[model samples]
Target: MLHTSLYCRSFPSPSHLRSLVLSSRLFPSVAVRTSPTLSLRRSRANRSIAMAATEDNRIKRIASSIRVIPDWPKPGVMFQDITTLLLDPLAFKDSIDLFVERYKDKGITVVAGVEARGFIFGPPIALAIGAKFVPMRKPNKLPGEVISEEYSLEYGTDVMEMHVGAVQSGDRVLVIDDLIATGGTLCAAIRLLERVGAEVVESACVIELPELKGRERLGDRPLFVLIKAKGV
Candidate 1:
């Protein structure tokens, strides 16, 4: 089904053949054989296009389903609410699929979710990624011996705690939160994970407030946001 030009030249000396093998090892990917075939190239191109379209559709659906509240907790703050999206089965299913696709093979041993809202999305992500789910709660909320981290918030200072034995040493963890504001709560979660000798593979959120500079406090870590708010 494919045809490629094969040039036959004079046989190379033993030393030259060894050098040629060395070159193949040096640039393995580039050295892969390519058979000239229009149909094969077209198939590859079509696969790429289909993948891009699927991803685009997923993003569009998620962005559209997210409803905007002019002032949720207070005036002057437009809250991006995901309850509407969760209510729709299709949208919620897609949301879970997206998270699973991103981290399924990333060696996630546990998923740590912040208190309250994070619980809604955390369990499913853990199941999809084949990892255990651990809840980080407010002070005195967890019934067991917890490793706690204290951080300052916009309203005041608060602390979040996690059970000490929930995650094991060197375990890979993924932190999930519904939204990113000042990153105070998330920073505390990260501290607790490290204190227990767990490595946080990444942090993800459905929405992010970029104007708040939450990413700055996270330091050089992989932070992923499905959508970004317009401004502060």
Candidate 2:
């Protein structure tokens, strides 16, 4: 005679089975293992947080590379000098990478750089993003026919010029500069671009002095900056 062991297996109740079906339909991706899905979400969140922290550290490193000179141009003036940043290869590359990462997917067709410092940051970004670089220069700097925007200075008015055909109507533009002090130069750059029928997507700077309220002067246009400098 042969004997077999009797075992009992439990099956889900009809209501329980219906609830499971509804849950599967509502959350198909999470039907496998709830714990695993939650763990995956936590992992992704951790990765995002780590990426953000790394980017913050990079910005801090770039900002620290800039040397501040006190009373060089005049008394009671603190000037942020980016020459030191250029001297450090890593810092300069970080600066460019920061801008490129932000603007790469922004549909920017033109990179408009303001006079001197903007030229330094603009070319690298333009090349990285495959956009045309247009120089906003001082009077008589460009040999071609140009449009000029005049902005008031401390004592008088100055002008910024851009070539006539450099930017066309409906072109998306990004304006670049090293620093924003009084917002005069950037305002003029925006005006010049808008006058030519190009849309100024945003203005970017490496350092921003919030006390100067340069962003307020920009009105509806957005501004991006890596570092916000205090007491400058």
Candidate 3:
């Protein structure tokens, strides 16, 4: 005698039963399916969300206290003057915090700021991260045995100097600059650091000019920029 229990499935119809059996046999490994276009759309949506989050964080951190000056350094150069950002208490603090956060994990033995403008941001980051502050000065600025590297600027050429004994062998350094145009100054700073037996772990800047490919001269060294201007 056969024992029929509730577990025994009842067939809907002969034709329906046959169709189900044929489908199962033909495609036994079939799983959930979605069109390729749908998958692409989902991936794009995820990327957009990530990008938006990054942009929002940047906006909140970047000081809107900057002033725009029409051609103070040169004609037709709209300088994005940051004197206001420097004066404001909160903005200045935020700038230092951002730099410190970016380079905290870079194992920086020293923070080297290039020339005049770099002096503003570099020492603060060095203090915050517990690293020694090193200065990259102009020609004849520091009175000691020095190493110098020269490179061209947008309008002319300039040389940067550093004290020979500023960085010890096997030390890791981070170079900071206000802006990177053709990257001449930044490259010189890298060479100066390396000349004294220090390894430049990374370079940080406030702005990058992509059109000029300012970063290309340094090969694959890590670079970070807080903002990029238009046409770059």
lDDT of 3 by residue, 1-232 (tens): 0222221235567675566556654445423368999999999999999867866565465637666677767776667666777777776676676788778887888999998879989988998888998889988889999888988887788899988888898999999987777778889899888887889998998767676788897788788887776322
Off by over 4 Å in 2: 1-40
124-155: candidate 2 lDDT, tens digit per residue: 99999999999999999999999999999888
Clash list (residue pairs), candidate 3: none
How many clashes in each candidate? 0, 0, 0
Model 1 ranges off by over 4 Å = 1-41
| Candidate 3 global CA lDDT score | 0.78
RMSD of each: 10.3, 7.3, 8.3
Model 1 C-alpha lDDT versus the unseen true structure: 0.84
Worst 10 residues of 2 by lDDT: 1-10
- In order, the Cα lDDT scores of the candidates are 0.84, 0.88, 0.78
For model 1, residues 129-164, the per-residue Cα lDDT tens digits are 789999999999888898888999888899999888
Task: Give the Å error, residue 86, model 3.
Answer: 0.5
lDDT (0-100) at residue 97 of candidate 2? Answer: 92
TM-score of every model versus the real structure: 0.81, 0.83, 0.71
Order of models, best lDDT first: 2, 1, 3
Q: Which residue pairs clash in candidate 2?
A: none
